[model samples]
Target: MDSKIVLITGGSSGIGKAIGIYLTKKGFTVYGTTRNLKKYPDFTEFQLLEMDVREPQSVNRAIDVLLEKENRLDVLVNNAGVGITGPLEETPNKEILNAFDINFIGPLNVIKSVLPQMRRQGSGLIINITSIAGYMGLPYRGIYSATKGALELITESLRMEIKDFGITCTCLAPGDFATNIAAGRYHAPVNNDSPYKESYGKTLNTIDQDVDKGGDPEEVAKKVLQIINTKNPKVHYKVGALLQKFSIVLKKVLPDTWYEQLLLNHSKK
Candidate 1:
């Protein structure tokens, strides 16, 4: 069998880079997308294409290039996203829209661009890279959570919609993974006079610390491979520390108020 061709958006760094490297090593032909192709003159783990997920034209062009070269696309990893942190009330409308555009709408653009070819091939796998924070509303990171959560639900709908076309869609929600996401993350300034200053400041610090101490992104890459190899993949999969994965379970069984309190307690820590 010919090697599977995999395209990973946002593949220049972080979890995306890890996945591309792992897949390449496993004998899959990989293409990773970055907005600016010139930034990484030395990216050799896989082929890199220029694509900004937020733009449909750019997405289509990149896919066209890949399809022209490979003639078939077997896998698409919707991994391009941005992180946003701020008190909901304090975050600017533009910033909120920008976050949604990059995190939610961006993936949609890429998915739409690739679907026609995938349908033509009658078999394709799309793995959406979501977040554990998306499972619940984090205090300061509500917008980011909302974006991932939306993608999670969208993936569910997409899976059902495209199943007839022999297309599979699933979401992988990663908990704090040590990555450069923080550096590119949008943070509404914590103002001296703002009402949410204290609590928001603390929560922001905690968020960063978690990322700083987060797990290796290669774990997520491994899980992606596992899902790809599975005969029938589940709609949702999570990769993170034991406690982080357990939080989803806790959300299932605990009382609403109790779970809320648990989150409050954790945030206050």
Candidate 2:
């Protein structure tokens, strides 16, 4: 058995599940998390552990079990997340809080649970699955961008803090991918009088279309495997189509007006 142990949150589906299956084929021991154990993956090489990233106790118990069984966790992938799409003003406060709690704080909970074990081992990798949205704010999904942006900042600061202990933290900023996010998106109710409803509908539809036609999840899985095999991984990476990846760079150097127009033109806002 490969001695490396990997724990991935939200592995029941989407990018997380893809990563788990891919890594297991490479001989790594992967423990994947699902909110419901009955929904566990059918793969023999992939073990399903019950977990809800929203709960600290669930996070702790799952990590404890993994460490008890493997004695060391070589990697922790914070892959669990949710998305909310609506005009910033129309989006309910409750929904905003939920998005933040799941996308931002959830990763922190998992990190806290796994750190002591990693510190004992003297080396570990914490990969926070953020998004390209984290770098640039999008209309309707502004809060999601905020949550991911927050995690990106956290990852940046965390890298320096734990480097001396042989622990490394990095942000995996994936571009659009074919996933279940479209179905789970929480869209605010459009009141009859809301001025932004027309534009909001158009923008959200464009996003859904992009997601449906986005890059394959296996591509992301391969990139992750490459990161795992390397002795020293970089601080950040973008995995997706060339255009999607290039947008980050273009945003960096473009004039503010040009960058704004590019985003608006693409989303038809």
Best by lDDT: 1
Give the per-residue lDDT of model 1 (tens digit) for 88-163: 9989999999999989999999999999999999999999999998899878888999999999999999999999
After superposition, the stretches of candidate 1 with alpha carbons farther than 4 Å from their true spots are none
Tell me each candidate's TM-score: 0.99, 0.96
Clash pairs, candidate 1, are none
Give me candidate 1's TM-score against the actual structure.
0.99
lDDT of 1: 0.94
Question: Per-residue error at 184 for model 1, in Å?
Answer: 0.2
Q: Give per-residue CA lDDT, model 2, range 1-269, as digits (tens).
A: 45589999988789998999889888889998988887554656588899988899988988888888988899998999998899988888999999999999999999988888788889999999999999998877899999999999999899998898899898888999999987777988666798987887788789989999998898888988888777888889889988988999999899989998899888874
Listed per candidate, the RMSD to the true structure in angstroms reads: 0.7, 1.5
Off by over 4 Å in 2: 41-45
* Model 1 alpha-carbon miss at residue 251, Å: 1.1
